[model samples]
Target: MMKAADLAAIRAIITRAKRWDLFFSLLGILSLMVGVLTFTVLFVDMAIQGVPRLSVDFFTSFPSRRAEHAGILSAWVGTVLVMLLTALAAVPLGVAAGVYLEEYAPKNWITDIIEINISNLAGIPSIVYGLLALGLFVYYFGFGQSILSAGLTLALLILPVIIVATRESIRAIPQSIHEGSYACGATTWQTVSDHILPYSSAGILTGVIIGMARAIGETAPIITIGALTFIAFLPTAPFAGDPPAGLFDWIFAPFTVMPIQMFNWTSRPEAAFTVNAAAAGFVLVFMTLAMNGLAIYVRYRLRKNIKW
Candidate 1:
């Protein structure tokens, strides 16, 4: 039989472990609290200073000057155009490539080379993409610094991210789902489209949304690709003008987007421009927040609708 003293010692050892676990838990909680508090303070400060300057004119009219500067309308429109066209250029192709690689591609040296290149492309700095666009669109192909040029650059810049995201989303579907479909004599395409795609749709959308948020904040690549700080006209259909020249008109034609405009406003010598910058910053923050909120909503719905 064990002695009472021995029993007491074992209990003491277990008690000591419990204390250490509680201490670490307390430490983790404190760290989280500090992070939350810091974020709150910074966001509150920005909002306090920024809310007053955010007016309808700030949204509707073109930037005029100091107190009287009218709006961010043109910049907002350009940013939308850039993002939309970029999405058109990147999404379907990226998703299709991801689907093919994740689903159908044989693992071979050629495929391995492509995979390696895709991963490297993801890590390449955005400015490098700008240079690629500059060389291809401006100097070599001569697309000019137009909206299409910026869109094409951003499309390339975001492709790896979207492809990686799409692959992950597809991979998350259960293999059993595919096997079951196959047992039912469903073709591979039908099984993938009907069963796998819907289940992973939310995750894929989330990844795209997150990627777009990052793209919206980009400046260096767009600048390098010859996105101008100011443009008199809104971007319409790309390649509508007389072409076949250097196509410099294609890629190098001057364009502007919100982030570029904000950077320009902030760098000006005038205080009014600085104010416009802050206001623009606030708008950017809002847009980013909305995108995140959408991702969260989509994720929630996905979880809710999915059955065991």
Candidate 2:
């Protein structure tokens, strides 16, 4: 029923659109490569500068006045302990808050206010969180300048991220899944436990890992809360103190993390310390990459297991 002229005009329009699409496709690839190549080049440069410094002695020794003798044992141990405490505090609370808001909280003005505040909080600068922690955790609660304070500060910093990720992940599941579960006479808790949580685990885990990656690299808040820049001794191992350490004793111990250690080295006047900084930076980047890789692996395994 179409005239030849009309067919030709329609074909021309599609051809023009296809050309534009191809242009954009190439543009997108170029943009992505620019970022990837930039990061790869920098990472390679850092490795070149730092790889030689990675040795058994570097990992085993503690900080020293001599740059050549300096190591990151104390720093890495503190980072791990702080991160463990942060995860322990943040995961359950963030997940619970997200689950409640998305599944159970009534849609009211108060809920809207809370949601808005949480979103705003996520965008606030890290330094603001540091100030808040200094006041609330350090002064009010008397947590003091210790691992407990740093862990709590970073936990608060990442809580909103996890909560947002959780809600979004839960929202993504098909409505029919919920309906089907209820149709089977499952209780609310049963449906959520048996279906919702399992289905969204990949997304939740991804968010958690991302939050932790950010937390691990945080320096401003830790410094603001009085983390020592040159701590040499490790926190007391659980149950290994002179008086037989209490279970939570280390939480109250002073600590230093990788970022602070790197900062300390980079600030030194000596060239040798600069090499140490580069090495520490390399290790930190590798840790971040490892966490991201774990996230990808988890997401893959979880999605592969999912029937839908």
Best by TM-score: 2
- Sequence-dependent TM-score of model 1: 0.83
lDDT string for model 1 (6-103, tens) is 99999999999999999999999999999999978866766766678888877777655444565677788878877887899888988888888887
TM-scores of the models, in the given order? 0.83, 0.89
lDDT (10s digit) by residue, model 2, range 1-308: 99999999999999999999999999999999999999999899889988999999998889899989999999999999999999999999999888889877899998999899999999999988899999999889999889999999999999998999899889988989999999999988888889888888889999999899999999998899878998888888788968898888889988899999999999998999999998999999999989988988988887787665
The lDDT of each candidate is: 0.81, 0.92
Worst 10 contiguous positions by lDDT, candidate 1: 244-253
Q: Which stretches of candidate 1 lie over 4 Å from their true place?
A: 1-23, 65-67, 236-253
What overall lDDT, based on C-alpha atoms, would model 2 receive against the true structure?
Answer: 0.92
